[model samples]
Target: MASLWSKISAVLPLNEERFPLQFGDRVESSVVEMLKRSRRQLYSDSPSASRTLNAQVILDISWERLNTGTWRHVDKEWRRVYSYGCLFKVAALCRENPSEDEILQAVRTCDMSFLMGAAIMENILQDVVQILQSEIRKSAKDEDDSEHAEVKRIKIASPHVPVIKDQLAVPRIKCPSLESFNTNYLLPLKPVILEGIIDHWPALNKHSWSIEYLRTVAGCRTVPVEVGSRYTDEDWSQTLLTVNEFIDRYILCKDGGKCPGYLAQHQLFDQIPELKEDIRLPDYCCLGEGDEDDITVNAWFGPGGTVSPLHQDPQQNFLAQVVGSKYIRLYSPEDSDKLYPHQSPLLHNTSQVEVENPDAERFPEFAEAPYLECLLRPGDVLFIPVRHWHYVRSLELSFSVSFWWS
Candidate 1:
């Protein structure tokens, strides 16, 4: 019986020990009675006779109270009871063949403490919703199977490359006047690799900006780091660690098995102001319609194999390679339809097709897109126009700075 209970516990999201059943032997009867009493109390005083009580309503009420700061001063026991009711509704909704007995059993086994159990209940609800949505989409797709099949057949035979006569390379320029840069690249909305611009920056010449030097200066400062090779991976997660710890784990102690960790697109200068003295804003950025304070600067530092998936940014970017080489690819906004952007809200701006090893069967349209590719070395800055799809992969342990402006 104990082993059976352990198997059930592993399968279910509930914690049996935290929520002991109130009625030991009469589990089904007690659950039914408790639910009836609770429902009556909830709807009894309501004036609207047609008011519909559902799991979503319970979830909304609980979420609003918890997230909107309304329950901050509420009694702890009352909040627990409300959270328990929410969990009960979620369990009832998630069960495959829900019955009064089964739902009550699940609820009774769930942890009743709101603070401890709410996250588990929420995750369970999300999983159930995703399953239901997937079924709905599958049913809809089956209805249009013939049309989809025809489309797939056409895509398989379609010519892969765009009609452009020749591949274009991003122009590389040494230090140019602000006027020439504005006219040649900035106004034309074309990308250019700029050299000699960052030659005067103190970080280029200073040993204080080196990896060991950074460990000594900002070692204790905690920052958010990405703990996966790519953000698109299921195992990707963010965690806070000190600079020295990140260096020790991802940068220096790199066993072949170490997953990529990136200190990416973070405003590290604001957090550790002492590090900002290493670099300066380019004169070309001042030509735009913004004050010096309006320019947003961010830092990107990571070990080799770190990837930034194909995504577009809202503001124009000048990505300066400070430490190591990076391979970059760009697609124009005109070819966005060919890129197969993700429909999900979290990755809407990102392309679904992997640039490195694109599956031809899945993303046939990608082959038709004209693109520009480059390899950026130290002191090279690449101009990326706003909304242009760009992907980056670090070839070596790298530190790069990005300046964003209108």
Candidate 2:
């Protein structure tokens, strides 16, 4: 029943005298030397050396004694150094105005034993390193350019999206039969654009899904909306808002500078059953080995300039443009290595290189990657095979429904 601070204090004592705070190369060197000498004393069992191996001796060690050793000796020191270093670092962090929640999290999760060996110590070190790196990055300035006007210098060149010379264009057809679509496109893993396919959907009619009509149908229904220009941006966030609020803030407003609010990838039909009557699942989805109920129907509604970064999905998709237009660029699975996918877990499926504005210097291989581009209009259904990299940008205030099936 101890408080969080008390738990932290038990693990990492707050007494300034016991854990004297120090940092940088001096402290690192001292800790390394202390571990080396401790090992030597353990093997030698010299009485004089044993007497000198107290806390004070450990603190006042010289870097000359910290020499390289065998793998066995090196591994031991690595554990001791990390365990001892992390304790001091966390103690220092507590004094530096860290939030109570941060302190509580560390206390609850961290293994506090000074005797913990290399494995546990290594894990703790990884966590501490991440925390420190985040803090350092936050404190760093965005731009390093100097203010003095001794000479005018050209800025770093803006990114340029290269055109592919032999890009494989996705085939487009007008109202192809269900049997032809399955045999020609679905079975062969070929992408196709079906024109005049969703003309029968009620959403295509302006009166059915106008701002006023949307508000009347689902105004009070809470929906998760993404408030940002793009999810790749740092300032992007999601919040729950009413359909009416979304219409007012994003659909009706004329502020060009504000970030767009997008209601994307949500199952609106499930939330409001009335919306299910607006669209129908194409028979092409039935060609796969799943029932009609297995299909995931989601909506994407946003203003112009909204972007969906380059990413791949696990299921085949039919992106049907109900209102307005969108520009789409797709890269084949074979060119994945050339795309420079993000290393972070949160965005592993997304490409690090921007398609609209690519940095040639950092991602030079991207220039060699060929991609198909198209502008989708109302009643157009673009088929996206699973794992095909696609990036989308709204060319105008657009509303689209995507159907994904295995």
Taken over the whole model, the C-alpha lDDT of each candidate is 0.65, 0.64
Q: After aligning candidate 1 to the native by TM-score, how far in Å is the CA of 239 from where it should be?
A: 0.6
> Where does candidate 2 clash, by residue pair?
none
TM-score per model over all chains = 0.60, 0.58
lDDT of 1 by residue, 1-406 (tens): 1132233324343443333224223224634455444444332433222122443354345444545444555444334434545545534333344433333333322322223223333334223322333332333322256534533342243222222223566778999888888999889888889999998888888743566557544554456789998899899998877676787688764375276799874457654555787888987898778898889998999877788999999888999988777888899999999999999997999999899899999999999898988888779999999899999988777799999998
Q: Estimate candidate 2's alpha-carbon lDDT, on a 0 to 1 scale.
A: 0.64
> Tens digit of lDDT per residue, candidate 2, span 1-406?
1232233344432343334233345346656555544434323434542433332344233212233453444444444444453343344334335564444333322232222223342344334433433343344343223411211111121222334334465678988887888889887777889988778888876446655456545654457789998899989998866676787688655576275889985456655555777788876787777998889999998877789999988899999998777888898888999999999998989998888899999999998998887878788999999889999988767789999999
TM-score of 2: 0.58
How does residue 397 of candidate 2 score in lDDT? 71
